[model samples]
Target: MLLEKINGPDDIKKLEISQLQTLADETRSALINKLSKAGGHQGPNLGVVELTVAIHYVFDSPKDKIVFDVSHQCYPHKILTGRKKAYLDEAHFHDVTGFTNPNESEHDMFIVGHTSTTVSLALGLAKGRDLNGRSENVIALIGDGSLSGGEALEALDYAGEYDRNLIIIVNDNDQSIAENHGGLYKTLKKLRETNGNAEDNLFRAMGLDYRYLEAGHDTAKLVELFESVKNIDHPIVLHIHTTKGKGLPYAEKDRERWHAGGPFNIEDGSPLYPYQGEENVIFSCLKELLDTNKNAIVLNAATPMGLGFVQGVREEYVKRGQFIDVGIAEENAVAMTSGIAKNGGTAVFGTFAPFFQRTYDQMSHDVCLNDSPATFLIMSPGVFGSDSNTHLALCDIQMFAHIPNLIYLAPSSNEEFVQMFRYATTQKQHPVAIRVVNTLRTTGVDDNTDYSVLKSKIEQSGSKIALIAVSGLLTMALEVAEKVKEQTGNDITVINPRFVSGVDEELLVSLKKDHRFVITIEDGELMGGYGQNIAAFYGDSDMRVRCYGISKAFHTEFKAEELLDQHGISVEKLTKEIIAALRSE
Candidate 1:
């Protein structure tokens, strides 16, 4: 096979033009094979096969330094950069992560999973190269979808005036996670239709030299385009139009659904592994909120499907102006939500917890300072979220709870979340943040607890020992309580602190009278988290305190079980620790 001969970029440079085409086909097949077995960014890798091949064939990596925006399209790059074994062999499928990782290979410059950060990062690399008095091709491969990001736009504006050898390749797949948004996308469509000869070219207007290729999938054309700009003295933008899911008919037909997913069958494109969870309460609450509340609206950055508002499902509401997607700009969406709530319209914005980290300033200034009464749903936070270090959002409490006038609630059950959502939208008091953990277990009873009270719930009141649990960790606390009852022949108090923003002073004071030792457990980092408040509250008092949580670090590919156990939040560990503490007293 042509792929066997291609161990690295050196092998690709030795190939003839026709052999290069065969190599592209083989690389695509290998991508499909591994993705079918292990699953990954499907549409992105499939589309970038030719582009990656051409780039490796044209430029020298490691020395040349090509960076991929978001790095979802790095699969083909990995295959060309001496890592094709991971794709061809099923056992080695998980040898590398889906995104760019410097630990995995020398070709990958940065470990990136977030979107639209390529230009700025690449600009930094270019500046470093100049500082060292070295001249090597510095390229940033970004997509049209990423152009809407504030970082990419700022970098593009700066690149226009940057008098250096920097190449910016805009891979115009014409689709983001969903269909493209904003006027720039319309300009891209026009450029594609006009064969890059449109009036008022976007690149040229930005003060950068511009060139567009209609056939981005054409390897020979792409290689020639790359060769034309290599080692050039000035910055340039190469606009290339390509298909999102190039070879797969199903993926091409529904680019959004097939963008990224679990392993699927090659025969009929059905999922090999079923979804691991049942119906989520978050989306159901969102759907009902939009259905009943006419004055209410929902907004997302670029992840509508993450909120269960898939393409056709949200069409009617979108037409009614009840749903808005602001593309990949989280900061804009956050500020816009504040504006919406300020104007007497109910606005709820949702995004993954890690992505929401981008809007910390906007959330603190625009929403909390103005007291906009907007509802921000932080999805899949803590150690239970994505295992990737790039997307780990362990410091949400560190981010949200500290902000003044912001009520950051951690709902312990499905019913609590529903009631919390109701309370957040109905009131006009303060901005609210809800940390929806990886899973929501139900109590099978309706929760009408008044969240405005901001008090912890005591599941079992007892003397000598008190266990204070945060949100999702309440289950573990309860398990530890049961173990304590079974082994120690003593009842331990278990308190679920639903609110993380601040301590319920009355509740903590009440515990001091009866409880001797307090143990606080959370699913997030130990420092600056919900548990610390409890520890500090008993600092000057006779009640000895212990805080258990995941330590401060960018932990990746970790199981919640292992993380919890290591942090001393596990049932067995906590139970024994509780017994030992009581015995000492």
Candidate 2:
């Protein structure tokens, strides 16, 4: 096989121009063959096979660095860069990551998983190269969807002025995880329609030379384009239009659904494990809010589907101007939500917890400082969220908890989430952030707790020992209480601290009257987490405090249960520890 013979970019360069297309076809086949079972970014990777092959064939990789924005499209790049076995061999499927890693290969310039970072990163490489008197070409490959991000636009504005050998390849698949948004996308559509002859060119306006290639999948033409800009003195933007999910018929027809998913049937594109059509609680709450309140709106950066606002379900609300997708711009989304709230409109912005890292500055300055009553839902935080080191949001509490004028609520059950959501939207006092659990634990009852008064609820009352469970770990806390009761004939107190931002001074002081041991178990980082607040609250008291949480580290590819167990958060371990503490006293 052509792919088997190919080991690296050097091997691809050894092949004749006529054989490059054959190699690209092989690379795509290998990528599909693996992802059909393992599942990953199918559409992005499938679309970039030819472009990656052409880039590798024309440019000297390790010397001439190539940075892939988001790196979701780097599977084809990985297959050609001495990592084909990970795609071709089933046993080796677990060998490589879905994104580019500098640790994995020298061909990979950065370990990037976030979007809209390539241009800036490539600019740094170019600047360093110039400073060191090196002349290696620095290339940045970014998708059209990522172009909507503030960072990419800022970098593009600067790259236009930098006089150096830098190549910017705009892979215009015309889609983000969903359909593209923003006025920039309209400019892109115009450029594509006119075949880059339009007078209103975003790239040229930035002061950079531009070229257009319509046949993006044609390996030879892509190679020609790359060759022309190989060692150019000035920075250039190569705008190439390509189809997302190029070779797969099903993926091509439904681009959004094929962005990323689990293993599927290759023949009919049926999921291997069919979706059970579970109720999306988040979307149901949003629908209820929008249906009742005309002034209420929901906003997401680029991940509309993350809040369960899929293509079919979101269109009607979007038409009503109640649903807004800012398109890969989380910073802008946060600031806009603050504005929406200040103007007496109910605004809720949510995305994956990791993505919230980008909006810390805006969340602090624009939202919290202004005390805008904007509701922000932090989705899938702690050990249960995205397990990649690049995407681990173990610091959500650290980022949001201590911010003044912000009330951060951690709901342990579905009913509580609903209650918190209602309270957050209706209240006009402080900015609210709800840390949504990955799995919804149903209580089958309504939560009518008056959150205006910050307090802790004692789920079960006992003497001597108290367990303060944070959000998702409440279930484990209950189990530990049960085990301790059965084993030691003592019922341990279980406290659910609904609020993370502030300690319930009344409730905490009440605990010190009867409770000797206050153990806080959280699902995030041990340092600067919810547990630490409890520890700090009792620093000068007779009450002994112990905080259990995941250690400070970029932990990845781990089972939530196992990671918790390592932190002594398991029912068996905690029960024994509590029993021992009880016995010692």
For model 1 the TM-score comes to 0.98
Which numbered prediction scores highest in TM-score against the true structure?
Answer: 2
lDDT of 2 by residue, 262-322 (tens): 9998998899998886688888899899999999999998899989899998999999999
- For model 2, state the Cα shift of residue 108 in Å: 1.0
| lDDT leader | 2
* lDDT per residue (tens digit) for residues 65-173 in model 1: 9999999999999999889999999888878888899999999999999989998999999999999999999999998389888899899899989999999999999
Listed per candidate, the RMSD to the true structure in angstroms reads 1.1, 0.9
Q: What lDDT is obtained when candidate 2 is compared to the true structure?
A: 0.93
Quote the lDDT for 547 in model 1: 89
Global local distance difference test of model 1: 0.90
True-vs-predicted CA distance for residue 74, candidate 2, Å: 0.6
Q: What is model 1's C-alpha RMSD?
A: 1.1
